[model samples]
Target chain A: MQAPVLGVKALFFDVFGTLVDWRTSVARESEKILGALGFDLDWLAFADAWRGEYQPGMEEVRSGRLPFSKLDVLHRANLVRMAPRFGLENLSDEVLDDLTLVWHRLDAWTEVPGALTRLKTQFRIAPVSNGNISLMVDLARRNGLPWDAILGAEIAGDYKPKRQVYLAACAAFDLEPRQCMMVAAHSSDLAAAAACGLRTGHIARPNENGPGKGEASPSVPVDVAGSDLADLAGKLGV
Target chain B: MQAPVLGVKALFFDVFGTLVDWRTSVARESEKILGALGFDLDWLAFADAWRGEYQPGMEEVRSGRLPFSKLDVLHRANLVRMAPRFGLENLSDEVLDDLTLVWHRLDAWTEVPGALTRLKTQFRIAPVSNGNISLMVDLARRNGLPWDAILGAEIAGDYKPKRQVYLAACAAFDLEPRQCMMVAAHSSDLAAAAACGLRTGHIARPNENGPGKGEASPSVPVDVAGSDLADLAGKLGV
Candidate 1:
């Protein structure tokens, strides 16, 4: 539990479900975009169904069954596959493309901006997410998320929970893994990053999926833990 | 004359000469650091000597004489090779490493900060330099460059003046080359980018190499040209 978080030079973030609340944002985006197209359906379930394809899609790349494809590409393919199940058949390519980009337009957790601004004062900050470069860019631009670099899956040419993704991000900053901290809401992500020798900080995004549906606390040990990014920032002495 | 500069979505900058005055900055840094240890030489010439190796070093990778190496690695090797001439032979690895990082400590031109801030309101801005990610991050943090992403040679796995570097940057943003403008002070850089279908904007760095030694104007045609970054920002209607 006593990892050296104080001397960390970089903060590598897990974007989805950590910095951003994808469930409500995606549900809202789906409702607005698809609701206008005369599609009356359970948008939250639609959001859940779309997100449900995330792991299996990544597992394909992670297992080496398929070559490394960006998260955006995987999101699109997953969207197309699950579209029929929601009775949303024969959606135009443009519409499908628009929906796929829902991931890019998600809103950040409320306290993330202030925490990140404070954290940037002391450390290099970047997204170490499975999201592609462009997706991260759109989200940052939209939400004023001040990232020092867009790195991770696209830069590593591999997905996260894979050692390369975490290591490549640290290497990109020319810092040792122990000199960097991986901050995420998910223990699995933190565990993977920890296994790669990175210090772990947890931000409890209890409502990441929906009210009371996300990780409210870390199940595993971490160097630091906080109820939100602002608390995490304070905990880190930033 | 018309390359659709108005519709450009992203601005990819050439950092060394275009955004930062590397020669003066490096010379000052070298004198301050190395002179303290009692080694003296014509530091301006020293800066030039270090930069002088840039093209040949990159050409090694470009010509496939060597595999792709980050600009920092090439710079360190070049520094080590040239050190003996300046009576800097047998320096410890730490000192050599510190000297090589001079590239990461360069200052932005006087008007660059304001111009980039103004331009950021309308476009996504990032360095498309051959400089590695950490170098870009360091330069940005030092000078408040405000880049949305640190991308270029390191992410592209190759050096600029290469078509892949420019194309890969565009691909990283999911943007077409035509939708992005390559902004640099060097005509060769602009021309190479133009060949890859990117529009070009030139900001004259009249003293980038030395007084009257840098590009006062684009040698080739460009979509836009200006006295400096502020002028370029104005010309681009930002």
Candidate 2:
């Protein structure tokens, strides 16, 4: 383990691909909700399509082309748009709603729960994801992720990579940017957080998008980098 | 125990004097911080003086005479205002700041942690407090309060008793007002929440102001009422 940074009083995490394996988890959950409906297709591909719409949806709000909406609201709209291609358009709103909520039920990567529990002992931990407050709450409740508060896009009334999300999160905890650390698997998230004057910790999620398709290390400079959240916790001497 | 309210998916609690004994706890913490500095006076009276300024401070924000400020900021202002009356106006800013933060170190009532823990198993739990997110986070950390998210005045951009505060809390969770319950020891808080269409649960803190002073029963009609948080949890079958 490398030396830990001092003055880091809070740790803000990127939820989707950093703490949880959204691809596999969403794929499994979508299948459960859709398989019984006799609409079977490439479940992994389905999950990818669902996530693939995330950026564009957030861009609509980030760019001010559309008013800000909760991540689930956008997900529902995107689901309705993409369902026809997979022969799922005929489904009722009830089933489609169930499918949209899969984001709330994403399973944490194997070490996430234990790692977060340990990390929390030394610092205030929260998700600074693009996910909305309710979405974040559901994920924490379902996965045993102990967050000191729910804060992110919804609280900031904007999407991530935007400066408000990171800054608002730090201010919400009554800490200066230097006292908060952004922990994520993606180089992009760390870079944005660093731009806002926050320290950054990178957690390797090599299989986040499937084998060899995710970040094994941060592409940008960070205060700390490690193999996983548990490794990050160990590196910080948690 | 009375029958539990059906469809109550979330519980929003009023903090200070409700979940925790703010008066006594703040008095003790204030003495610990101030006594060593050679300031000897009536600590309980000191606590009352500090609390006495709270509503007036919040009124400044509620009336739009001042922009919304976190409870801590207003507390600091109130602290500085009251310092002269206590013959301690010469205190340094650092000392005054510490004095203002005693609100964060308050102790929970004896049955709060256990009851809250049990209720959490059946419903989503959070503090819809006038205290800002950081203040609530500090209190939760110092005590054993398990909150799913910190919500309330800060999130709503206004003080409680405002319609927006109650409505915004429900909207944040993607829940209808009817599906959420406002639990507090004050009838005024409950009445306001009920006016916003939320169910109400009352927890009696008969000694909140002082023994035999606080209402052992609510003055306004409530969906449910009990002796304390634990009894409310039991009434709800938690």
Candidate 3:
């Protein structure tokens, strides 16, 4: 692989499974909250099941089958659908709401805070995730990630893999798509952003979805690829 | 007056006058930049004239006379329109562009940082100004405002005092209007938010418009009124 030259002005990140370790965080929180109520099953699988609904739920909006609803609302409906499968039923509405918000409390990958702080000194940084504004805000506050703004599905009124989400985030910064880099662990996200003319930087998150469920590298070519955000920042000369 | 009981969960601020001293900052920057370039005029009046175009510019979009453009674009157009009067006509595009970005560097009012840091412990805080996302982000970064997200005209695709802009910001937080307090130095801003059912907190910015041109207090009733952010935070028991 040759060293790539890029002129990126801002970096837009995919939050879930990219900057944050959502899988483990969700599993841990599920066990802590649900275990307290004596509803103990395969917590990790429960977490996976909850996350499995994410894409299909988004597809409903992307396909225009439903008007855009925020990720929190979708998460709640997903949680209800998966609740009975895990011996959890009839939970109070408040408790169910708290469990769904586990996504908002996900812990960041170890190097994210330091790397992002370094990146911010050189380039504008924001999360262009599918998560809604309140969820993104909660996650940023909980983890100390210094984002310039929250940009994503909520503001775009559409989910990614959809081109409007990528284009809208760039428009928010008044930058051409080519001037912004999309950083993510998932190649598909980078691919979607790249398709919209954003530069793509890939970060390896081998443990993003438990041990064996995550990809260790980008499955496709990107402008830059590195082991993590710190490495990516170094690669970009930040 | 008896202390007003409030159950506010979030505080949405009007950034330009309420939190930051934009009039002074813009005038100072204009004088420094344009003075260096050998143009002379009443710099403060130049700043006022520039801002004076803001509401009317927004009204163009609010009335559907023009499609929604970000505040930065509108500011640029307004700057160009006022340039000849200030002996700034025929400046290079780069210089004009840089001048328009003066809004990004506005200094926060003296009590903002400390008061907001204290208030953050109790509520979700954000700027619900008409400034676009990029402008708000740059201003927040320059002034050390710990905003959870940037929300306003750009995100809402319409400027305030439009009801949709206020309602959109509240919706971003999944908050009821009554649960969010709109904080501002301008009565009309508060009045607009209040009409949308939001609670209001008035901050006195006596020098907001380069002295005497600005109001020192809300012209209408509000749930809370204070001398500055620190006073407001104290009044709110933060």
Candidate 4:
């Protein structure tokens, strides 16, 4: 309810569910691919299941149970395994490669780019995503994300919720961790960033899954919270 | 001469000499600091010596004679040793810190931003500098360099003229080394990049030392050569 404090020099974003609607986008793309293959399945559930793979897959890498690899490589590895379960038949390597790049072709939430443009006038904006730099760069160029830079877990050889990842971003910007704010829809990311001494902002993505979809509340108290990026920008006076 | 072929997708620039007039900038700042202390020295030569310290300092790190350190840290360590030689006296920690950031406050060559803007429309423009990321980011933001991203040798744990530095930029953009181009005033930087399979462009910074001073030419053959950034942009038809 109260106005958010200013003086944050850089805003690090959680890319997937925060700035972009990955679930809907991935489901739609999977549906199209399935249709093209003359097959059908519950694409929505498949999309959610694929999304669910992210945290655990990253855990494997973080725990050294898996070899060091890029998010794109991990995404592709997951996709190849999930394809048959989702009724994808006889997918060619070229087709799978194109599908892996679907993450790079995600649409920005309608309010995202506009809010980012306004924020860019006053602050440095970058995505602190689990996605690799190349994937994030391609996504930004494709969606006009207007990121001043792309900060990724790849930069630190680890994923989010890791203190080193957030510290790496602060180091890259030459700022104390407290001077940068992590903006995300997820509480885990905000909590991790906050624990690492960063300020935090929560932008609720109520329609992140569209009509009748369940929405969860952030589990931690962030420095600020808002309904969307537009509201967050307004609160930050950008 | 004939029009240069220009199918380069990304431009990886040499920061210190290509975009920024480090000689004048560093000399001016060093002179101001020395004057405040009532010391006198040929600040221009001092600047050259300070610049010269960069390579050997990095070579120490590169050759494993010294531990890996960021350029700013390396610069500060060298400056502490070189300050007495420059007749600087009573330099406190704060003064040393301010002096170390001289690299961060560099002024761009007058033609840089405009040419970069023009080229950005056709190619991804970034600085592939030996400078660290934080220093380069500050320089770009302060000087309005319009870099799409900052690629630095610090990210690769080594300095330029090394293959890993060039390969890091290509990896960052997810491009084949040949798809990217190294744009530098120094032919040797371009040669190093080319040896890594990148394309190369040379924009002659004849006034690299300001109005009357001259330096030895880089001892390598660059792929494309032009008078300046405008001339280079024109050659690239950007």
Candidate 2 lDDT, tens digit per residue, A126-151? Answer: 99999989999999998999899998
CAPRI level of candidate 4: medium
Which tens-of-lDDT digit does each residue in B19-106 have in candidate 4?
8899989988877876787777888888888887888788888787887788999999888777777666468999898889878888
Which runs of model 1 end up more than 4 angstroms from their true locations?
A: A1-3, B1-3
Q: Which of the two, 1 or 4, has more DockQ?
A: 1
Candidate 1 docking classification:
high
Ten contiguous residues with the weakest lDDT in model 4 chain A:
A208-217
The digit string of per-residue lDDT tens for model 1 on A93-191 reads 999989988888999888888889889998999999999999999999888888889989999999989999999999999999999999999999999
- Residues B85-116, model 3: lDDT tens digits: 87777989988889989988899988898899
The clash count for each model shown is 0, 0, 0, 0
Which candidate tops DockQ?
2
Ranking by lDDT: 2, 1, 3, 4
Residue B62 of candidate 1: its Cα lDDT? 85
The two-chain DockQ for each candidate, comma-separated, is 0.88, 0.91, 0.80, 0.52
CAPRI tier for the interface of model 3: medium
Candidate 2 lDDT, tens digit per residue, B124-178? Answer: 9999999999899988888888899999999999999999999999999999999
